[model samples]
Target: MNSLSRQLKQQFSILGAFVVSFWTIEILDIAIFSSYLDRFGIIPHNLIGLRGILFAPFLHGGIGHLIANTIPFLVLGWFVMLQETSDFFLVTLITMIVGGLGVWVFGAPGSVHIGASILIFGYLGFLLFRGFFQKNLPSIMLSVIVFFLYGGLIWGILPGLGPFISWQGHLFGFIGGILAARWLSSK
Candidate 1:
């Protein structure tokens, strides 16, 4: 294979490994929660409790929900991680913590929404901004394409989309990602 193809393959392999690991953990969390559904609740009445952080990303309402989130998680994750593995992890970790905190802080009592979109949006925002600043043609093109494709995501971040989905969490995660990316780039 040519050099470019070889590099692409290697990068994809790395992304695949990351996705597999994330998927495995998610599945395990689902299995554990399914077996103990009575014990876990989506709402966070307590302040900054353990469940506030751990449970949101792990728990899904159903199989459809899980499937809906998986592709975006993998694709956006690959994009974000491809630039720099360390940045990928940092963005994801901060997104999750900040997103969850946003929900806990602003969400209605008994409100809960769980998915990877927030982190995905954050990563996308970071990539787009980075690409713009760096003046990298390919990255800039990719960001434009993604923005056009998933532009509707902005609406999902707003409240009143659904009773169950925590748009607040999504909004916070996205904002956190944008802020983080900007901060990272400035340094």
Candidate 2:
């Protein structure tokens, strides 16, 4: 196979493994743990809760929540990978740190925030800003496509969507993505 084909396979495989892990953990949490794992998610203003920054994205409330996150995670994540696979990891990391920290700092004291929405918003942020930062034709075109397809999601960053929605995560995740895009594109 050609180099591009090989890269695509590798990217898809990595994304597949992530999806598989999400499903496996969800199945185990529901079937074996009785949703106990969810407590590990982000809980603001508590020292122990800080660890949730690393774990929250992988935990979900239920199959319905996981199902809601799966498509956007794969699609937006793949778009980030299209430019460079390493950027995918970097963006995820930055989003988790910034988004997680945001929730930990500002989220409701007793509420638990979990799900890949953080990463999804991060990907959206990166894609939307990458074109402007990179200042290239390909990046511009990709950004436009991503905007047209997912721009409606931008509203998620605001409050009043619902109690369950972590707009803090969405907002910070998006900021992290833009930060990542600026940092990466500069280099």
Candidate 3:
């Protein structure tokens, strides 16, 4: 394959791996582990819960949660990779670390936060603001498009919006995405 073909392949592979992992883990969490995998999620202020930073995005509370996260994950993730396929991987890692740590530090002390919404929100924020940080025309246009498509999701970051939603994770994930845009642009 040519260079462009190889890049597309890589991008698809990365996106596929993440989405498939989400499904696989959820299947195991439900059918095999009997939802016990949920315990692996982020538990605020708990020392042992720190491990959730690495695992939480992969373990969803239910199939519905994973399904809700998958489209945005693929769509926004694909956009992030538009600049460089490998950038998706870096962005995801940074988002997870920053968002996960925020949940650990500031999330409710007794609650466990699970699911890929953190990454979803992180991706949304990154797409919306990356243009400003990078200061380019195409990126800015892309940012506008993202906002038009997903602006309503911004409300999800607010507290007390609904039951079982981790707005803290959404807020921190957004913060992390902004940081990632700045950090990546500086590179």
Candidate 4:
């Protein structure tokens, strides 16, 4: 296989592992833990709730929630990786940290937030802003493509979308993505 094909295969493998792990966790949470693992999600303002930053993205409310996030996660994530595989990792880490901390600091009191929306929004943010930061033809084109496909999702960041919707996570995740794009493109 050509180098490009080989790279795509590797990227798919890694992304597939991510999906598998998410499914496995969900299955275990339902079969054995009975969703008890959800408590590990962001609890906002509490000390122990801090762990949710790392765990929230992997925990979903139900099969529907996981299914909702799965396609966007894979597609946007693949777009980020198209430029450089390592970028996928960097963007994810930044999004998790920024988005998680934002939720911890500003999320509703006594609320437990759990979902992959944060990462999904993060990927969106990175892709949307990456071209602006990079100022290259390829980056610009990728940004346009991402915008056309997912631009409607921008509304998700606003408050009052729904009682269960973690708009803060989406907003913060997007911010984190912009930061990642800026940070990575600078180097």
When 2 and 4 are scored with lDDT, the better candidate is 4
Model 4 RMSD, rounded to 1 decimal: 0.8
lDDT by residue (68-134, candidate 1, tens digit) is 7778776776677666556777877777777777776777775555655667667666665666665
> Which prediction has the highest lDDT against the true structure?
4
Candidate 3 per-residue lDDT over residues 8-100, each given as its tens digit: 888889899989989998998799889998998999999999999989989898888888999988899999999977677778888899999
Name the lDDT of candidate 2.
0.94
At residue 74, what lDDT does model 3 achieve? 88
Superposed on all Cα atoms, the candidates' RMSDs to the truth, in angstroms, are 3.4, 0.8, 1.1, 0.8
lDDT (Cα) of model 1: 0.66
- lDDT measured at residue 138 in model 4 versus the true structure, 0 to 100: 99
Candidate 1, after superposition: displacement of residue 164 in Å?
1.6
Pairs that clash in candidate 1: none
lDDT of each: 0.66, 0.94, 0.90, 0.95
Per-residue lDDT over 56-85 for candidate 4, one digit per residue giving the tens place of the 0 to 100 score:
999999899999999999999999999899
TM-score, one value per model: 0.77, 0.98, 0.97, 0.98
Assess the local accuracy of residue 114 in candidate 3 as a C-alpha lDDT between 0 and 100: 90
Of candidates 3 and 2, the better by lDDT: 2
